[model samples]
Target: MAIKFKSLPRKNPQDLVAPEKFYASAVGDGEVTMDSLAEMISYQCTVTEADCYAVLISLEKNIVSELAQGRIVKLGRLGNFQIGISSDGMITPEEVNASSITKTRINFRPGKKLRLLLNDLSFKKVG
Candidate 1:
């Protein structure tokens, strides 16, 4: 299976007079819902569908709890997730503090195995 992409007109940030260029943007095929994911996992082992669903629910809860505590959650080959922030810069080094933070975001760094899967990616352009 190959990924699908569509062309989108994008403007150059550096060149004010440059013509808009078309860039390839990925198009998602579909989503695998949690229920569907649990069903798929149930088929792989002795676990029941209900059990798989419960585990996924618990995993989500734990991941959120850990992230709230400012801890990085590393899922082995699945890579690590941590909280990242954007803040307003202060003039003095000591002037910066929590109030400087504008927003927080979850950051994911893909592991080697996960990135390796991308090597086989093929694109199909959307009409």
Candidate 2:
């Protein structure tokens, strides 16, 4: 008699999810487009490539301090937006200084549905 073993299933690297398709299909009776993103990116009265890069950079920075320097506005999903740090206690001198020194710290938070869609990392078999 020979011993037998069962091999685990192999995952195909080619099988990947389409973010654009997922975003479009799940926009809840709406469409997704480069224009839409461009509109969102133009929240600060401008839509240059530099502005876009600035926004992304601010998002990953010291958020608390960034807002204190001035208004840290971010364009969000569905044409919505968010302003950082309204109340006190969440602020420190360093944060304040950081905020003041940094220019245009934009932070965009995806909508609940968009977040859900992004969070969905389910894998499927290819072909």
Candidate 3:
């Protein structure tokens, strides 16, 4: 008996939805878990559970660590990710001079490669 092969459907780059969409939808409706997202991706991509987790884990670790530290960690050129400070106090220029403003937060600036990859909506093949 001969094995028959079936081609997968062609997916347009634009058709790729951001994970944020699902996150927003989940948040708007109810809570969703990491397992749920992993399952979803695995099902859609025909990937293994481990693969899904690996990808998610890497992303989570990088994002969290970048946000936690004071250094700007850029993800190869997607965009600039930074810690924003919202101050609602009256501090005159004189006061600014009096005390040194300390940064207890971290910011990230993505490199040009990351930005280009993101803007292109595609991941580059790394050797």
Q: All models: lDDT?
A: 0.94, 0.49, 0.57
Model 3 spans > 4 angstroms off: 1-27, 70-81, 88-91, 97-127
Clashes of 3: 6
Q: Name model 1 segments beyond 4 Å from true.
A: 13-18
lDDT of 2 at 103: 41
Residues 1-127, candidate 3, lDDT per residue (tens digit)? 2222333344356766633221111112256787888888898887987889888889878877877674455555465566655333446655543235444354556677755654554222221
RMSD of 3: 15.7
Which candidate comes out best when scored by TM-score? 1
Off by over 4 Å in 2: 1-46, 64-111, 115-123
Q: Mind giving the per-residue lDDT tens digits that candidate 1 earns over 38-69?
A: 99999999999999999999999999999999
lDDT digits (tens) for residues 37-105 of candidate 2: 555777756567566766656654655455556654444553333454332333556555443543433
Of candidate 1, the 10-residue stretch with the lowest lDDT total is 118-127
Error of 1 at 2 (Å): 1.0
